[model samples]
Target: MIFEKFGKKRESAPPHQATPTDDSVSISRRNFLKKTGLFISGAVVGEHESEKFLKKIFKVPSAEVSPKEAVKIMPHKEKHVSAHSPEALSEPSPEVSTETSKESSPLDAYSFLDGQIHPVAIPTGELAGNTFSDLYAMYLGMPNGTVVPETLHVDFKENLATLWRKKFNLPARSHDERVEREQLQFLEEHHNLMNLAEYVYRSYDAKSPNTMTLEEYRNDVVGAVEKSRKVFVDTLPLVPTSASEDGVFSKDKISLISKMGESLTADTLMSLSFTELMPLDKGSANAQVFGFLLRNAGVDFIDRIPSVYDMLESFGPYQITPDALSPKSAGSWATQVLSALPLGFMPWNVDELLRGKENIAAYTLAMLNIAQFIGTRNSAQLKCLSEVMHTLPSTQRAKAVLSFVAAAHHRPHEAYDAFDAFIWSMYVERAHSFREEDILRHIPTKDLREYTGKALANYRFLASGASVNNST
Candidate 1:
């Protein structure tokens, strides 16, 4: 993305200007102070003091004065030369062009972070290349129209890392330690589901054997699924059908039975009626609710569960529950719950889905399924989710998906914070007036609420005039 700087032609200085003299040709204090405005006090300076002051002001080498010094010498030569006029001395010296002065001025260049501006030093040396400028444009673009070099040097890297740590409210730790701490926090939160949680943790951990290769990572995930399956099977009742066919009637089943009664004759109803009817299962109810909401929201669901299951299974390895599944046995059961919407549903307007409790539940269940599938932190799964999220109609829903993914993963806090930064960048280009809090408010998921608070606090810290330069 880097662009090469187009070299602009410069006008040459007029030949009438006098060449600069060496330090040996010293001007008196009165003449020097009047020309360069380096007057320390009203008192007159000696010859040696004038030389030192001139050298300091011009930043010239001991052996030679810079071209700017030629202007100071021109004033003294007024009586000697009629061609070298005062106007020539007033003209911008060749060495100090307007563009160069503007580039070096701190007032002309600033960086934006969460909508606040901070002065940035102009880059120099190899760092002056276009790569850094493109990087800034890609990530943290300049809010002001001024073009300043934004390089990736030691200072810039330190600033970014410091900003990241401050946003997360994390203590000073190496990247490895931070990852470990996050993993441990995850384990503490999901201790009851340690087998699956640990599998996800180890799979994503940089130090683990699971990350040694793609095949190794896949094998580890499969092993975790097998372990979870064993636990589920061991706890299962001896007669599965008996438990499934319990006499308790679900609300939907009760409504159905009541409707059937209305169509039946009194004698026929008495003979055919059973003492108890099994209620619709929780999964069926969720599916029914999901279908209803989707239909209401203008989505046509043709064979919701089957179609959705097919799509979910195609997303590589996903285990809805520990039960036997397809597309690499570790597939998720939540797929059936999420499948209510058609596969081609992209740029989906989820505003309608946020209206009612049933819609929320259906959406939550679908997200939960997606979270489970992504919990493994498999690269392929993340890539797929990223693609799907981008296809979402609005940035709000994309952020919601990101928040859900973060919540379902091992490091929800870190994930949420990172996405917050991303969201800020996205809005910077899309809506200049929209603040980070404004964008955060639109995110539908509660999972990101706490993280959003922390992120805002960090932003406030930056906005409160706590300087990035002051950070360690």
Candidate 2:
């Protein structure tokens, strides 16, 4: 799902500083929000269970929370946020236009971007899809094309590679070449989509406000659905047999979920959360969503949750501003966490990952990116790792948490930027809700820098397959 890079950085003004998307709005304040935090969730998504992530995180009767709340934030009128905001990240548009506009602009092309993954739309034949194109047709609840139930059976990896070849006009090849070239092409697209995701969040989600019009809403529906399938689907491994930790979701229910996953992106897989897919009541909507995500992202995706969370905590565009963060800050530490992924000790630069890597290097690089962190960490991210563990219930703790302190990247102060204004801090004075004891445990009351250093060194050596004697 890697898209070609746009020439200019599509900078959006933050709400306070926002200019009008149309003539109706005015803005007095804004910032560029240029932060270099890591991306938490690496793989593509937007499935029937999209809302389930939040539900699982905060178990309760489901509120009317939008499925992809992270993508479209309604306006919050605090000192930091303004009443007049862009639906871009969000402040709802001042007015609603139910009827289609008399004319349209280039932005109209992104109409498919409604970005929720509810209805199932499977592409057939030698067709196409992209983030800015038809990728989100199903999510917009305006699925197009002749979708047969059989499309559910296509091989996820092979189909993606097929789409890559057809898009580029690369000739069909023998088995050996298909194994080599198509695999390489798929990896390249994988890296490319990561870059584009960064760009999309940095430019649009970070700064510009978005509007929801009757016509524009229609397109956002389609465009967002397309974007998810094209972007995250590239990173998923093949789906495993869908089952809960205790195996609650039945085969028939799992099949329906598989169908939903496949329709969204021509595969069966599911992803997100720690411990428990949800209650097993076969008729429950929550149960169905859990089953759907399980089928769409595959079982191993369960372990990858923290790694993806690490990326969101560290690299998410809204989190860090290079200048505001000093060298000693946790933001720098989060950057190191990216270098220390358990996938291997390759220092991954997003630019290098997105370059002319149309060979094995692309696939290998993605392996490191896609591989789970296994709760690994250097001194830099140890507290953040512990926080992630704390975010989970003790009952939900599994071997995944036991593998903690291995390798991951993220900083606490910078990580909370999305919750507050970008004015986040290590002390977190504004976040009164976090328990004092919980925060105190991770914070080093007495210096244990030596143990911290050794822990990081040992883990890196172990993760990289270096011998104990190689440890510093």
Candidate 1 global CA lDDT score: 0.25
- Candidate 1's TM-score: 0.16
Quantify how close model 1 is to the true structure by its C-alpha RMSD in Å.
33.7
Candidate 1 on 1-472: residue-level lDDT in tens?
0000111111232110001111222333224322322122211112222233233322344245422232222122213211112222122212322222212311111011112222234333222332322112212233223333443222222223222222223333323645445533532332222221111211111111111221222233344333333332222222111111322333433232222222222111111110000011122221222222222211211111110111111000111211111011112222222232334221121111112111222223223323233333334444434443343354334334433332222233334344444444554455323344554554434434443333233223322333222221
| Worst lDDT 10-window in candidate 2 | 266-275
Off by over 4 Å in 1: 1-167, 170-211, 238-472
RMSD of every prediction? 33.7, 24.6
Task: Report lDDT (Cα) of residue 225, candidate 2.
Answer: 38
Cα error, residue 308 of model 1, in Å, equals 30
| Clash count list over all predictions | 11, 53
Alpha-carbon TM-score of each model against the true structure: 0.16, 0.22
lDDT of 2 by residue, 336-442 (tens): 33323334322232222212111122222222222222112233343443343344443222212111211111122211222122112322343323332232234
